[model samples]
Target: MRAPKSHVRVALATTLLAGAALTGSAAAAGFAHADSSRAGDANIAPVGRADLHPEASPLFSVARRLPKVSADQVLRLAESQVGVRENGYGGGTKFHDWYMNSPRARETVARDGGKVTDYRNAAWCDMFVSWVGDKLGIRPAMGWDAYTVSHASWFKENKRWGTHPVRGAVVFFGWDGGKLLHNIDHVGFVIKDNGDGTIQTVEGNTGNGKVEIRTRPTADVVGYGYPVYTA
Candidate 1:
């Protein structure tokens, strides 16, 4: 989570891998109350942690032309990014560059009380999710946003929020492993439910700040947002 100003910075914990810290699901099917602020730890902050990194910013690059793809293709596309990492302080990767220039960034900045540039190296888990949606040419159905709470709220508003894990579902997580919206700490795609009260997921901005496949207990999930995939 971004710690700049009123935004809360998230302290990582072992909600994910054992002895490791940090880490989603549907609409509000199993959730009791989900406010917009409960996006994710990375979702809520305008900037993450303390900005200890000297700002060696990259020159803005043009967003790539997105190729139209189907929902069935999203996992493959998301999987292809498995090893990508930030250039530290969240500045590297096509995700940051794309979000920096997109109209969605302007929208988020308008509502979230931050300059567009403050996102330069801000916590970027949600940005990575947005990037994949744009890449697959499904931004409307797949949805996109910098803040996970707002993004998850979008799904709720659209009546897409739910409780169960389905392949390709956008997952919302709370650090406390509870069902409240404000506790949400991260976002990712559900690969599958392991059926042992565990899930397999691919997430950005995790595990030393790289995209990783992780096994997490269901207790950590706030819910899932089901993007309309057939569009």
Candidate 2:
């Protein structure tokens, strides 16, 4: 149901990012991928990889550049991708290409037990989240992972987990609707609390296989992950 980015995602981003610090124009944040020949994304610049690994940056990857990371930045970048659709074949988008090419794909496959190419067409809601942060050069604070459960667990382990919706929180969900992280089936970035028991969100791999905005009930949220955004 949730399938994936393909070509023209900008030339620089064709290479594997692998938690590498990213820098370049805002186009690098596009939701699609550069073609195999490095044609780049048609609508956006692909996020280029910097030599510095994620471990090296820890949490201030964007701090070195913007010095003031905000949820709005994340929202804007995510919102810009609203109409992005996955390749109809289900395995050909840039998100898949990016993740597949990454060293993290191996780590994830080893931990999750699968071949790296299995991710070529895997459910990509989490990958979408990872892509957004990676492009923003905030993966250190934003965190990145392919599985929703592991990603949510990371937030808990880091002491960045919380209840209550806040603008920019990473919201984990259980389709059956509850607070059990293990039951979490999906994830998205919070846009705002509607005060109607729902929150507006921007999500990838949703709505006919395209990135789209959604209104979800709080009852479905397991918890929120707070990133270390600058004040």
Q: Provide the TM-score for each candidate, comma-separated.
A: 0.71, 0.72
Q: How many residue pairs clash in each candidate?
A: 23, 15
**Backbone clash tally (model 2):** 15
**Against the correct fold, how does model 2 do in TM-score?**
0.72
| Top-scoring candidate (TM-score) | 2
Highest lDDT model number: 2
RMSD of 1: 15.0
Q: Can you write out model 1's per-residue Cα lDDT over 100-167, one digit (the tens) per residue? A: 88877765565567688877877788888888887766675556777676666666654456778878
Candidate 2: list runs displaced more than 4 Å: 1-67
lDDT of each: 0.62, 0.66
